[model samples]
Target: MSTTSTQPANSRSRVITASLVGTTIEFYDFYAYATAAVLVFPVLFFPSSDPTASLLASFAVFGAAMVARPIGAVIFGHFGDKYGRKATLVASLLTMGIATFLIGCLPTINQIGFWAPALLLVLRLAQGFALGGEWSGAALVATENAPAGKRAWYGTFPQLGAPLGFIIANGLFLLINFAMPADDPSQKSDAFLEWGWRVPFWFSAVMVIVGLWVRLKLVESDAFKKAEAKGTIRKLPVLEAFRTYWWQMILGTFLMLATYVLFYLMTNFTLTFGTKPQTLPEGGDPATFVPGQGFAYTDFVIMQIIGVVFFGIFTMVAGPLADRFGRRKTLIWVTSAIVLFGLTFSFFLMPRENPVGEGTYWMTLAFLIIGFTLMGLTFGPMGALLPELFPTNVRYTGSAIAYNVSSILGAALAPIIALALLSTGGGNPWLVGIYLSAMAVLTLIAALLMRETKDSDYTGDAGEASASHPAP
Candidate 1:
């Protein structure tokens, strides 16, 4: 893409494609590691004395990625704001692809002794670091290309990448499982850890090329151009975020807390807890899942596939909803729906025997729909909302800091905390529900306090708008 702000139809289309493709690739790499952490890394990399402890350790490594995210956000946000969105995006993609590919090449615990898990952690951190920079850059690309009246709609184009990435990731894993022999569980798992796991990570290399091709074809945003023209750009974008946009950043982080926690709970936590027989009650094993016979990895995988499909559907729906209903209202309502989702499905989805066999399957489907639908509503509008919260001079850095730092507070500890709650609360998954609800409640409050910014003109004076709106 050219580095000019010419509003050609071709330019807009190219920018949207660039944002969608890049974000999709970034999320794919990030979620691939998350899936591995839950399903394979515990056994392959971190071998603990207890199975649960091993899984916990794996989740900790997963969280390691989230922990590194803020640091990456700061570094990339600075360069993205100072240099440009395109440069930071390409660099982040390269970093993520290299880290993921190296992970595919790492030796298992049997081969490398203590270095196996250490290597896994190192690669995982790199993945987090890259992802931290990925979202905001992608968001900037789409919104910048968008017309004045349709920024949220265009912003949502990149948000679709989240669901699209999940679909591709889980669909690929499901395909691999189906291809493997059913009778040889050990052989299948061994192959998966030894080689099968590498396929998805290695595939990310192709995306880097695809993303670059699309991104390199797009023009920079009009807002950035205007900022550059006025010589109003910050020397230290990240530091400016801390000094001026600190309150907005804090509120944005908490505002996102519910969505992030619900995400891990629905995707990673459910997969882990659902597969373990012990997580289900003694006599209430649902027909769909037999705790002792076998936990339903395939079933849950299928559910996630279904979930991603709806997630895309709902994402499309949310754009117009925000346009019609206002972003804050949409976000508040969506978050409240998530709270109810947790309440309803927390216990209902647990494998339980009823007059009907496999009734929990329905519960699983219900939760999947509910979780994904709510995610679509809030996440779809968030790209526009966060950037609109700040001026163009500080937009890249300020929005990125809010987005990734929130990942640290919200998602980084979710799996660990949910598991701990499940383990300590006599295995009552309801406790996990409460935790999710609390985050949603916090987000609701933050949403209430936040000013609506849908009408803000990004191409005009962002500082003037900021003065009028004021940061919450």
Candidate 2:
């Protein structure tokens, strides 16, 4: 702890808090757009004749940010590795905050037509760019500042942000939705479409203010500082990262794919699938009521919030499990479970072919609990695992690229794919489940190839300093 002049003995806790808070704000901004894509973007931004086409258009623009994430990783990673983690982190937060707040101010299709979606695509890119730099920096700060044998446990704090962000994002959406006339079938939703959805995006400004305050309070992380002191920091971390750890990046990308697939499927895709109005029955019992049709938006949010609670619980459990069982092994088991869960998604998410009314809501909640529990298991160890893949010098660049690459390949396209499959099958969750299972298997293989890294020395000069002081 003596390596720093400004920080006190509680530096580890401070670092964890800062990382968690910052990432929460980042994901909150992210899911806010995701929720809007389904609930409002189709009606507000992409006006279309066919309702399916409109939703798909909203999802395509939603994918734009995922595409931009790797680019953000490059820009932020260069500066983070070149200068310091603290500065880059603060910059990322401000960038996302500004972009998200502006999204609230943008006009809808009624006001601007084509330019509405065009401008939205641009801001979504900014959001992705900012987040590309965020998670890696946050993860590193927590793990680098952790105690000897508690990297996974400390790392969980930053990992904690995903579910926390889900809760906060949906919690706000649910509250705002409650205040509006979204559920009223009497054609009273003009206020909701016109102004209600924007409230969440506009609220991000206040969140960013608080996030920046916590992040600014943080000191530089010990791991990055140690490498810098020894003159081991690389001038070009991107090239060096690929040269030394290219294969690791590929494997890390796949390792994270299952988790990303798991989340986006349940959260984003389900938001769209569960909210549309029902049409002519394709081939079902005429008596069975189809779920997720019109005005079910708030109900789905409530279901997701319940799942978030379970995700939070298992996320805490996952950290300790990873610490004891080893990171690679923990990931492998979780990925396998994800595969099985994906295969069984139809049974869990919908008990009957056409479940109607309150029973359907209970079934949806059950499915979310099952899916999100797996999400937590696969996701919680990542803050420790990704940074362990490369040495301290190129850690930020390596992990950032790998994390966001999975975003592009898996999450960036999930809702679009899910909706496409549903539109083809006349709303079939089984096809979406099969898509998830395929990605999960790929992730399982990547986990198999990776070695346990919990024992690696992360201090300096290719090895840790021998047992200096225990964790704070």
Candidate 3:
């Protein structure tokens, strides 16, 4: 269990691969669902008289998954903290994979009536539940095995999964979109709605198999073994986490708030807004029209993919910066930039005189690149910062709770709120920008309150000192 400087090279490689691949698969499954929520589910599953109503209903199901995440965090965190990371990680990946595959095979509302959306919600919650455990475990696996002075750098490996997954999932959808027979290059073919959209969901099964294989090869980290040897493993880690580290939990949650808000806004809300028509259709009533910067779905997705490349790059860049400058200082600077970025949303996203023209397209693409860049800077450090807040004994529980709890406050509400704000602003994105700015301010406060955790001892456990009895 001891990590020496001369740990086997393959062992280090396996640790990075397992942690990265597991989260890559988990995020792929999640992103597949997210893309469908915007494109297919609103029409196929919700089917309301109003388009906005249908989209809202679809987003509601998406947000419902966030509601289940905290519960998942508690359940998975308990076993992860008590038993070990390996089995719990495998279980979470399997659960997420199965749920996503079944979603691909589901009957649409037209075929199954009310049962369609009902079944979708169940599977969505399962995905959320699985992910609740997946991230924290993966972060632990990477950081716990890190060499001296490189925990932050190692931590970025798992965080890389987000952009990697986004690219793969969205790229697959883009390919499928192009392959389907359609008169217009930008619009979805009827065939896509009926079947093409399901391919990404089913593809998750194959990715999960690879992830499981990698994870099964993992050994418990040195930190976990040390906790076990010292009899620091608790019978009830969740209770102990809340009892001892509640303040850290609160700080960690808010620290993640702006990142979640920005992420969902960039991926989910932007997709919805970008694809909406800039002008009313011929013979349509002006009173009922909602203006948007109408780009074709395919075009906008390509734009998003471009921006996500910056997301991936900055994520890696954040790790080294955090390692050098400290997590708190790096996050404070990045979060402040996010605040300024939020203020510019309207300038970038709003419709121009010619919404779909070449000039507007370039501006929107710039907006996406800048937003995703800031997202990367803020999101990358979380893998190290959150886990560093708690000792090894309760680290899994404490970090998972904070991470997923923030999901409820930020990811769960961001798209729904942004959409409503769009409606409130009459399709101008300024109100949505204000919402993001407000959340970033909260995150800034949390960052200000948090102590620098760059130098925290990863292998120590304060819980052991307080324990009346050790695990036998």
Candidate 1, position 199, lDDT:
84
Q: What is the lDDT of residue 265 in candidate 2?
A: 91
Q: Which candidate should be chosen as best, given TM-score against the real structure?
A: 3
Candidate 2, residue 89: lDDT:
95
Steric clashes per prediction: 11, 1, 0
List the global CA lDDT of all models.
0.78, 0.81, 0.91
Q: Candidate 2, which segments miss by more than 4 Å at Cα?
A: 1-10, 182-188, 281-295, 350-354, 461-472
Task: Work out candidate 3's RMSD over C-alphas.
Answer: 2.1
lDDT for each residue of candidate 1 in 148-234, tens digit (9 for 90 to 100): 677788889889999988888777776777665456442246556568877888888888888888877755567777777766667
Off by over 4 Å in 1: 1-10, 182-188, 278-294, 354-356, 462-472
Question: Which sequence of candidate numbers ranks them by lDDT, best first?
Answer: 3, 2, 1
The candidate scoring highest on lDDT is 3
Residue 234 lDDT in candidate 3: 88
Q: Compared with the true structure, what per-residue lDDT tens digits does model 2 show for residues 299-360? A: 66787888888898888899889999999999988988888988886675543445446767
What ranges in model 3 sit over 4 Å off? 1-10, 281-289, 468-472
Instruction: Kindly indicate the candidate among 2 and 3 with the higher TM-score.
Output: 3
TM-score of 3: 0.96
